[model samples]
Target: MNSLYHGSELCEVDADGNVAVPAFLEDAFAPETSPEIVVAKHQADDCLIGYGRAHLSTLAERAERRRVAEEERGEEARSHYRRMRGTFGLSERIKRDGRGLRIPPAMRHLGRIDDLALFVGAGDSFEIWNPQLALESDDEHFRALAEFRLRMRGTKTAGVH
Candidate 1:
């Protein structure tokens, strides 16, 4: 499974809505075997999700597995399966040119993306967010992050008596 992504990085969105992806993540898309990328709504968060061909396929497979298993269960499970299927279908593939990949309209609106966006690296997928929204979310997000760290820190004595 792809690890959950976190944090933010600044990136420019061009006139045509294309944005350059961070070079560090280029390899993740290689499995997709296409320069084209897909942008869609993130299920659990207020952000835009980006997927390469391979990653999308992996997501499809997982959804399919859930669907098949749900089929054996009943109506409720089936409904969930249908919803998952529907979500995958909403994905839009981005076209790459000399500049970068263009963000699709649906995703653009969903993320409120404009001239500038913040690309956040999540292990298996990345999220694109409008700069202002990102800034607002970061305050709350970072506070939670700090709390998490504090909980995880081991207590130690500063000095011996």
Candidate 2:
């Protein structure tokens, strides 16, 4: 029987980046708990984005929209579109070899993934991040948000929109 997977799970990846999928998440990719997963680079940091066949189809649709949006745009927009395409174009599809989820070499290198891995759930999707990188990236985000909030508060007092 299959079930839905939710919540965040911190997991470890071997030197080869193959991670043992927790029982909770195992069913998330059910019928074949070990289907081939599509891996792409995370936009915010050196993290890998992974999803099963079902979710990847949805992502492909969104990517198509972004690709089409840049057709009549300038160089910068075109570059951004190209990057988006390349990220997905270069993505790797890894399958579970019965032992664990095999994180492909290309994705592992791109995301700087090593022994320590953090699997974070994002609703229907999930992110694979190197623990150290995730910590540093999260701290930077917090700092940036704090500074932006402070600036906004000051602007409010000055009647700035």
How many clashes does each candidate structure show, in the order listed? 2, 0
lDDT of 1 by residue, 91-135 (tens): 787765543678877778787887776676777778776655554
Which residue pairs in model 1 clash with each other?
5-122, 32-54
What do the candidate models score in CA lDDT, each in turn? 0.63, 0.64
Instruction: List where candidate 2 sits over 4 angstroms from the true fold.
Output: 1-5, 32-34, 70-77, 139-161
Window of ten residues with lowest summed lDDT in model 1? 152-161
Off by over 4 Å in 1: 1-8, 68-82, 138-161
Best by lDDT: 2
